[model samples]
Target chain A: MAVDHNVFITEESIEGETAGPLAGRTIAVKDNLSTAGVRTTCGSEMLADYVPPYDATAVTRVTDAGATIVGKANMDEFGMGTTTETSAFGPTRNPADPERVPGGSSGGSAAAVAAGEADLALGSDTGGSVRCPAAFCGVVGIKPTYGLVSRYGLVAYANSLEQIGPIANTVEDAATLLDVIAGPDPHDGTTREAGADSDYAAAADGDVDGMTIGVVTELFDGADERVVETVEAAIADLEARGAETVEVSLPSLEYAVQAYYVIAMSEASSNLARFDGVRYGHRGESDGNWNESFAETREAFGAEVKRRILLGTYALSAGYHDAYYAKAQDARAWIKADFDDAFESVDAIASPTMPVLPFELGESLDDPLRMYLADANTTPVNLANLPAISVPAGTADGLPVGLQLVGPAFGEETIVRAASAVEDAL
Target chain B: MSETPESDADTADTAAAAAAAVDAEEVRHVAELARVNLADDEVDRFAEEFADILDSFAALDEVPETERDEDLINVMRADEVREGLTQEEALANAAETEDGFFKGPKVS
Candidate 1:
């Protein structure tokens, strides 16, 4: 069970005996989730010693279905960074290339599956957290429609934008894991009351024949030439399999990253406010008045976490709310409209999961904008509240590329179908 | 993947304009509102970094406004009592507890 990827923050075995579809499978869970008596560090010093009092709904569901809980995986502190470098424990090295990053904040989950440390893993994607890492590590990751999975025990970063997803070696395995962890939860009111159950495993059997796949031209606009070429070749393989292809555009995509960050940060500012060192978070040494101790505790957050909390606070501040938060909501509505129009003409849309190959460890650490820009292709899915899957498409210069298949809201079946085709062709 | 889109020029212009909107003082103020105290050096660093990030976000300004739908209802189920966590379980993870309650700093 020892994988040198540094994927898990805490590696311990928990037994599960209820026989179900995922029987005998091992699952690596991101540390941000609540697991009773297990340390959920969330890749931050703020909760280094904190253990949850109860299990996350997803964890309970999977363990109830006979999946063993392997360990708590590392992540970007509170899921804020594009690279796992922000982890307070240590950055997870890409199983494919140690010198490069395993895309984050679900970097450890992807690395765990890619390195064979775990049979399947749970990752939460707010923007591109799950898919980006899956792309870099050459695995399949699914970000179900916004409310498809219950977020009851997932620690909040951006409540409206995040969902717990599956990362697995194969699409079938991913679907199996999804079936176990996904369903409506009374604890999380945001979860959809119905339409949560789907036989994703069955959906993976269909061919892409007669399916109209739209290539997202915007996704290719600024990607590396080799990466683009490799993805196009994958598309050509799909064409050879009898699928029709057409070029499509989501012009509002030009503004997705910006809008996503603004809304995410704003929500983060409010969600993170609860971590004041009083109840469960890390408490400070000083025994002074409540305010000073609270301030000292907040100072323990990682740099990226601080950056997001500060920026978010700025955006939601009185004089700026109209210019930033409101505008971002408008942009979100526009992006959703664009997706509705695109779906009218095409069954699904395809894009390169990320613009470039996984970069070096410290390449974009200091340039926050560059890290934010890398999420362009993936963020629109969150804004539009649709289902998307990232399957290993091809390799450019040895690093794996991911082909993203996006379908309409609650259209997991269509995305799973197209992704399975690409997964087989590649 | 590192290539900039055709709108790079416009992005640069927005960055330049937005940079002036955030300063060290603004960063410090926001940090205070969030209940975090930033060291003087952090204030300066965050000020410059946030300006760049905010500039990127300004692209939302180009979004046209749309009419809000009035039919959106707060998705709520019938309010009924359900099985829930006990007080002991809720306070089990607290750093300090007294009289079956989470202990905290004394309020003024």
Candidate 2:
């Protein structure tokens, strides 16, 4: 195993119950998830040494289910970047190819699973963090239906768009991990009992026979030629196994990336306001007044985080609120309706998990817009608050390309089964 | 669903506001609003970057007008007191605390 993946920001073995479903398994939790007594840095200097006083509902669920938490994994600072290079600690190298980045902000979680450092790992997906990393690292990741899993204790970044999910080497293993962490938490009011009562692991039975998959052309339009070819081949494989695909169009695709960023940044600006250098975040000298100290102390946040916060502030600013944030919300409504209309005739939607291949280290770091554009295919799913999974479809020019399967809201089982079929077929 | 009024100039102005380039002064102001201190050079750089980002966001103008039905429901529980974090636990991570209260920078 490669030892330099920088997959973990903090490594400590915490053993769970003596016997349960995950007794023999190990997990690498993203640093944003609070683990009691464990330092939970969101890869930002602001919270570099901050440890939570209580366990996040997901952490408690996993530990109670008998899983051993191996460590807090590295991530893009505040779940802000797509390439994981924005992590304040350092970038997590893709285990598949050391020079390339593991897609992030769940990069470290996916890298740990890919490098065999853990049996499974937990990652939070907001605008495709979990699936992007899983795609680049040749693993499976599931971004559950928005309210299926509890988000309590998660370091907030775009609260409405993010969810704590699972990353593992296979669809079944990922589903098994999801089964443990997913459920309604009294702590998080958005959580519902939708997929909590179903057997997600059992649903991954490679049962794509008779499943009707919708191929969203909008998702395919801007993808790399090689990636599109590989995903097409995977769909063909599903057809060989008795599944069928139909071309579908979501006209609102062009606005999704814009809408997603506006909403995410706007939410992030508000969410990150909690780290004002008091009550557990990095503290500064007490020389200045409260607001001054806050500005001075907030300098600990890295460049990408600052960028998001500033833009988010601008989006919510008085003169531009109607122009950006409100319009984005309206676009979100349209995108959700389009998805509902598409799902009326299809069981699931298929696309390339990422529009391009794994980026070389420091490639798009200079151009933030390029990085945002790369998320075109995955952002729509988040906008609609749907469940999607990234399964290793095949290699595109010796680089892994993931096929994304998106299902209806609370439709985890269908996506898991379809993802398992893709896994089996490939 | 309410339609975007075709004759409303205020709506047109709203569409144009996001596409305008944010100057360095505005960037610095926004940084202050966000509570992050940035160097002057950083402020200039952010202005240029924000311009590019805001330009991309101009595409939202084309999203068809529709009444959005966001499915939001309140999850209510019985109004009963539950075990909560104790004062000691709450103050455990505070960098400066006295008399069971967190200390902050002076206001004056």
RMSD (CA, Å), each prediction: 4.5, 3.8
Residue A278, model 2: lDDT of 68
Using DockQ as the measure, the top candidate is 2
Q: How does each model score on TM-score?
A: 0.94, 0.96
Quote the positional error of residue A41 for candidate 2 in Å: 0.4
The sequence of per-residue lDDT tens digits that candidate 1 reaches over residues B1-108 is 123332342233332344456767667767888888788988878877876777677767777885434224476779898877889877766778999988887654
Query: Can you write out model 1's per-residue Cα lDDT over A181-275, one digit (the tens) per residue?
Result: 77788788777754466688888974999999999898899998988998999899889998999999888899899889989999999999889
A313, model 1: CA deviation in Å?
0.6
lDDT of 2 by residue, A244-278 (tens): 89999999878989999999999999988888776
Model 1 per-residue lDDT at A148? 83
The per-model lDDT (C-alpha) reads 0.86, 0.89
